[model samples]
Target: MAEKKYKKIVLAYSGGLDTSVLIPWLKETYGCEVIAVSGDVGQGTELDGLEEKALKTGASKLYIEDLKKEFVEEYIIPTVKAGAAYENYLLGTSFARPLIAKRIVEIAKKEGADAICHGCTGKGNDQVRFELAIKAFAPQMDVIAPWRFWELNSREKEIAYAEAHNIPLKITKETNYSKDKNLWHLSHEGLDLEDPANEAPVNKPGFLELGVSPEQAPDQPAYVTIHFEKGVPTSVNGEAMDCETVIQTLNKLGGENGCGLLDVVENRLVGMKSRGVYETPGGTILYKAHEKLEEITLDKETQHYKQQLALKFAELVYNGQWYTPLRKAMSAFVDSTQETVTGDVKLKLYKGNIIPASVTSPYSLYSSEMATFDEDDCYEQGDSAGFISLFGLPIKVRAMNDEALAEKTGTHFPSVE
Candidate 1:
């Protein structure tokens, strides 16, 4: 083909098989110096020896940036406030892509590179997410997607290429499931998961590292309280901590309790359905607690309206529109609604269930005097007759018309009994 335009490329490297292969392929194809950049979003042991791995795989230099605090405070918290769960998913993988892309763009600029590269496959949603994020942050930079360009199609071919080139990779042919892990979640896909008919074992060993199996969970229930200030989580139980600490603590606690493990067959943005098993223990607990706090703090109208905005917000995040004006506007609305969302939520975690026990907000709209069935000075029982009549007017009208028609036709309408 034609010669590549760029002389230096910054790759969003994960030290995975695809990315490791891409480093060599990019150098061979374009003869460009590859600078690998990996964002440390609390991937834990995955980040170990990544610099040595990247440099050995033909990278000229490696930059591993720590972005855990920023990721949770900036991206994850905003999503939680907006209640952005894409088709019931907590947008675990979806939210991390933009932050990863942003870091890649930053490294490209710093290294004076003209192009950015990634290992996202052509058929996957991540390609769109990564590319769109690049377009948003640095529209002028050339994006090199190796999976879209390279002739090597399957994982087998890529692994064979890696073997031929003597590229040291952690993944082997026997266990080839593609995974992405961070502070928010761990996602598993590919290999045997491609088949819908395949039954996922209830207790698959080695497959689940983040959470306890339901059968292995503690018999006694565990309880914890989460404190939020303006919709952002501030503490666990009664301890005040920073953003990163809160996530780390919750992740450990929720994992031990088996609080969050989801297996879903979801439709991708690329018009294909894929199955993934996700472990999002911390995120699951946070969402449940946050929602419970909102139930007491927000008024009926505002709460319902925010729920509608949540669907749109989730779509934007899932579709990689994080830097868009619409997302910012929606965030403003979400923030405004969250002003009174400061509260404490007590929860009961038993096995895999996160049950909300009690919630108390400083701005709570709930009033015992107004809501109680007992005799109260704030409410008069006699007033319910007029209110109920007006509330059921449409239903009463339809029913009366149907009754009149039935009487005129000398036929009895269907009765509830």
Candidate 2:
């Protein structure tokens, strides 16, 4: 069958090695006018000079949309409120992919492009993430994945192609590690990090981008107080700031202390186990503080049940199911649990550790009077006797039946008194 020709293709441009080469490749291979769209999700300095570069690489134009504010409010807050962490990962790149893809579709529709393209490889989770999002909004739009199709299989080949085409490369052959960075976190994969046995070269240059290593962290502990309003962070250290500002503040504090380094071999949705190192400095502080706040505010049953919901929520986000109905339903359930999640949590950051100094909440369910051993009117000691007896009634009945049967049969049945 003949392939449908694409007249105009919208490419998710990152200005990185793959996408840098993609602008020319898409044009040369498909004979299509390439429109590059880069979503600005707080990837500092990565966006710089993207316009000139895109134009230089055969793209008709570039769209550097500022999606940072929307990214935090729309994606980051709900995930944090839901307490979703995929296998100890903070779901940074997971949730951001959908938002960026959605924006690309919007631009595609506006530009009247025949198709959309991404630089994600066939083996990674981002391919599913980008395409699933595109399918949700613009299912009919033709999608192009150059890495899965192009002859340039490795970074070495892509670098050679760029040089042949007079296209500049940001990274050299010696230090080419696939990385994804946003406001929420910075992730490092490939190189020696691909092997689970090898430890992350945190002390080495280019290994740690966002923060200091634990050994290089400061000797003195830094204290921070974060205020929350209905599961949303409102302030840091008594100063009221916007959510973006709040995150930036915590990122600075947490980065300095080496608080959020995660080195793990996680299950990728592509049916493979991949190793990566993530630095989610500010996000780590917020997640810890938010979870601690819920400890005081949420009831025992609600908290326990919410924890189960959180695990599923993380799975949905990690598996690129963010735009689906199940995720919406789970988010709704998470929001209901967060009504009373209003509080302030003080934490002590000491060299990769987040120690809770104190936690306070207006809606806290913790009762000092009931929990006190000295004297308490809220809880009756006599009631515990009745509660224990009732709770043990089923066990007592089973034991008596066993004992009766044993005696009649001349069999010894030992029971704890």
Candidate 3:
């Protein structure tokens, strides 16, 4: 396929090995000016010296915007409310892509760029997520996926190309595991993780930043209280804070207690299974607190229905359908249910266990008068007998009919003609 023509393009640059090389490659392939846009969603030290690095490698300009607050408030909170966890794994990296792609499109329009470029590999789910989000947000802007078009197939080849052109690289071949980090979670893949049989090097200091090993957790348990308003966490331990601060505080505390660490072989949307180790200390705590709060506030039938919707919601988010109508409808339903989800939950965090201490909600359907075992004016012990008989009518009728048939035919009713 012939390369699309463009005078300028906006590239989602991460200042990493793949994106660092992508900057120059876009320029050489399309002969277009590459404007690099890097969104800061709490990548911590990775954003250091990124602007200088981008300009040093032929970028016309660089936009490094702090999107941490927006990421948590807009994307992460909504996913939490929807209870969209894919295969028991939080959709951390999955949801971040759309927000990053939206910013890329905005920059592309502002710069009058004809196209947008990304460094996501062809085999990964991110390539689909990024391009699909770009398409959803900016249908007219052309998308350039370098990995799909480039002849170089391996990271070794990319490193060689970078060296041939004297491109500055931060990653070496020895420690080339692909990592994606955000405030919500950090994911590690490639290297030893690529082999399913290889056990994770849990003792490596570099591998265990988010939390201490479960063995190292303090013997004394830590307690935390989270307050929720309309299903979104509003305060921690009675102190009100912004969305970003709440997540940051929880991350710190949960990490200290060894709260969130998961290793799973998950099925990728692209039809391949991959193993990943994720650390989501804060998210783990928040999920448990939110779930326990809902138990008190929501009715049994509504809660059961929402559990069914949660699975579909997880699938839609994981498959990168954030902008679709079905997702919008699901969000609307989730929001409606959350109106009564105001509550507070107390939890005990000990050795990676988050145990619910207690939960209270103003909208709680639990009536002490109706639910208490002690006798009271609202006592209804006799009503249960009639209720049970009515509820079991179908089963009783079936059994009687089967008995009559068995007596008439002298055979077991279910086994005979």
- Candidate with best lDDT: 2
Query: Considering summed lDDT, which 10 consecutive residues are worst modelled in model 2?
Result: 1-10
Give residue 359's lDDT in candidate 2 (0 to 100).
Answer: 99
Q: Top TM-score: which candidate number?
A: 2
Model 1: per-residue Cα lDDT over 1-417, one tens digit each: 426666899999888889989888888888889999999988989989988888887999999999888898889999999988987889988989999899889888888998998899999989888988899889998888878767888999999999999988778898898999998998889888778688654377888778886677899988989999999999998999887788778888898888888888988998989898888888999889999999999889999999999999999998888889999999999999999999899999899999989999879999999999888999888999999999999888878987998989988776433
- Model 3 reaches what TM-score against the true structure? 0.95
With candidate 1 superimposed using the best TM-score fit, by how many Å does residue 190's alpha carbon deviate from the native?
1.2
Q: Kindly indicate the candidate among 1 and 2 with the higher TM-score.
A: 2
Off by over 4 Å in 3: 415-417
Give the range of the ten consecutive residues with the poorest summed lDDT in model 3: 408-417
| Predictions in order: lDDT | 0.88, 0.92, 0.88
Model 3: lDDT of residue 396: 85
lDDT of 3 by residue, 335-354 (tens): 99999899899999998999
User: lDDT per residue, candidate 2, 328-349, as tens digits?
Assistant: 9988988898898988999999
